[model samples]
Target: MACIDTLLAAFAEVAVDPDAQLEKHLAAGKRVVGVGPYHVPEELVHAAGAVPFGVWGCVGSSVEAKKYFPPFYCSLCQMTLEMGLTGTLDKLSGMMITGLCDTLRAFSQNWKAGMGSKVPMIYVTNAQNRFIEAGRRYTVEAYAEVKRRVEECCDALVTDEALARSIKLYNEWRATMREFVALAGQHPAEVSVSARSSVINAGYYMDKAEHMSMVQELNAALAAAPVSLSGYKPIVLSGIYEDIPAITAILEENGFAIVADDMAKESRAFSRQVPETGDPLEALADGWCALRADTELFDPRKEHIEQVVELAKDNAAAGVVILLAKFCDPEEFEAPLVKKALGKAGIPAVTIEVDQSTESYEQARTQLETFADLLG
Candidate 1:
């Protein structure tokens, strides 16, 4: 209980600071932890009283990261390492990475061999198989192992009550963030798309109460706005780590409304928290399994894909934009499949490749303008 209290207190400090977001909080004594893409098991980290930040590099710097990581390594890994080498990730005490793809597996090894400042590295398995029995077992084992490792890092043990409370708090936070996401889709300019994106992305790393406050502020701002059509080209963005709010801002300025998007970190991570339980670890394990099951490549429900199609259809979006991180295998792997499906649905789509250092917004603008023209 004391440990949970301490964890939440630390998170609140990071969340509400007028000047200190995660970058500022990292300077403090708290241990900064990193979680890779795919089944990060963040509930366990938050429960263990550690800060878990997602390590997708910010917009624009691929050319520099390329010097260190080979071309085979995905852009996401390169971006992460770029921050690590340049001392941006100095605040991190450790990293929790998964073997989500071949690039990630190799990058894990490089993290140990290459970086002079090696934060503690915790490697978790990324079950490639979807929701078969074997896959479920692999996920369960990974969740348990991650929970144990988080315990070791904090010198803390998991209590049933503490774990349950952490899960509940995080779930509430997720729901509220989701609400804010829907609001952003409804009114991008009114919400400050960048601030909403940062708050939700950083929420995964910071405390719950602080995140809740940020959401409340966003919700209040939305509620107070006047009602009207944005009078912009309706666009639905799809992909990962799309930090180029400049494009969205430009589109909005040109009377384009970013009605719906799947590119932002906040859009991807805002699911209900694992439910509270008498046995928190088991509950957490269940939550991880549930999320994986929902997002599995072959999910029979086809919910994720369906959601994308529905969002496009519902918004009557003028066109769909896909922003892929160069060398992001997961997005690369998923894009063609998504494009084909959406094409069948008759939604016009264009795909762009950008990295954390997105230096090509002008080129992208030309493409977006053309896409808008085609839709007309």
Candidate 2:
């Protein structure tokens, strides 16, 4: 329990104040790089001996970000750009921006124009048509640009051996995380939804190697002290950021345990480990190719719906929860499809509208209570 509490406290701190965590890392003489949404070459950053801190936007209305994006734009983009403009992310040695979505495409331009001087910027793109040889080549070239920018910023060459080592370390981290998520399910009575999310989210802000060690300890403790509850309900959370902190407590109070999620911010990011056998950069690019059905990326095939159904079945979940970020078009587009898929699979699901700066979750609470009641 002490180990659990300490890890949770650390995760909560970093989730709320990512810059503080990054600054602490910097003070340790390690360079940290900021990366925006969807896919990033974290292995490349790691290979260069730098930290790859996820720069998913904050929890607030970004008033200044309006100059670049409309009100309907994603808060993830809004708050991320606000951080760059406000210099909240100035401590980063550099930042990597990707053009996965329209908002991010505009954000890349805005960030370069506004925050590029403050923090050197790297433009990255994962090939959308990623199954073809041409797409693979394109992705490799794109990653080469990312590697070059990363090298320029750190003044180091990311050797094949270094990249291979990073890939191995990251794969170990991914394996540990998978084990952690599975273990979290067995002890849901003790592990709140937020606690589970935090343990996973901590990986983005902290060193993977260090996070993996602690996760291993936490998983061992959890496995040794498993909690059994006949009435505890398991569910899969599918969407982008499920970071509405209060919702977790409310869900636990209402008897929900998140066993699996297809969130862009959570499992989807690290589910595919970079292969250690291939040419390192090519392997990293190939990992990006493996990222499927993520709402943020361009996937006309929409395999995410199938993935969600499988997740629910595999977890024995009573239902699926759609924590849809309000005004996020991609997620909004996905919501109905997910609902339809779950419905067809005979799975119950509830969709709750959410935003970054939610002052109240009274509606969410009622919805959750109603969903939990239906699960019975």
Clashing pairs in 2: none
lDDT of 1 by residue, 2-119 (tens): 2322433444455334235565555665555777665576666666666767776555465556766776656677777776676666666677877766777887777766564466
CA lDDT of each candidate? 0.65, 0.84
Residue 178 displacement (Å), model 1: 1.0
- Segments in model 2 whose C-alpha atoms lie over 4 Å from true places: none
Writing each residue's lDDT as its tens digit, candidate 2 over 263-364 gives: 778788768877779798999988887766777776788888888999999989889999998878788988999999999999999999878766789989
Question: TM per model?
Answer: 0.82, 0.95
Off by over 4 Å in 1: 1-19, 22-29, 60-68, 202-205, 245-249, 292-304
Best by lDDT: 2
RMSD each, Å: 5.7, 1.8
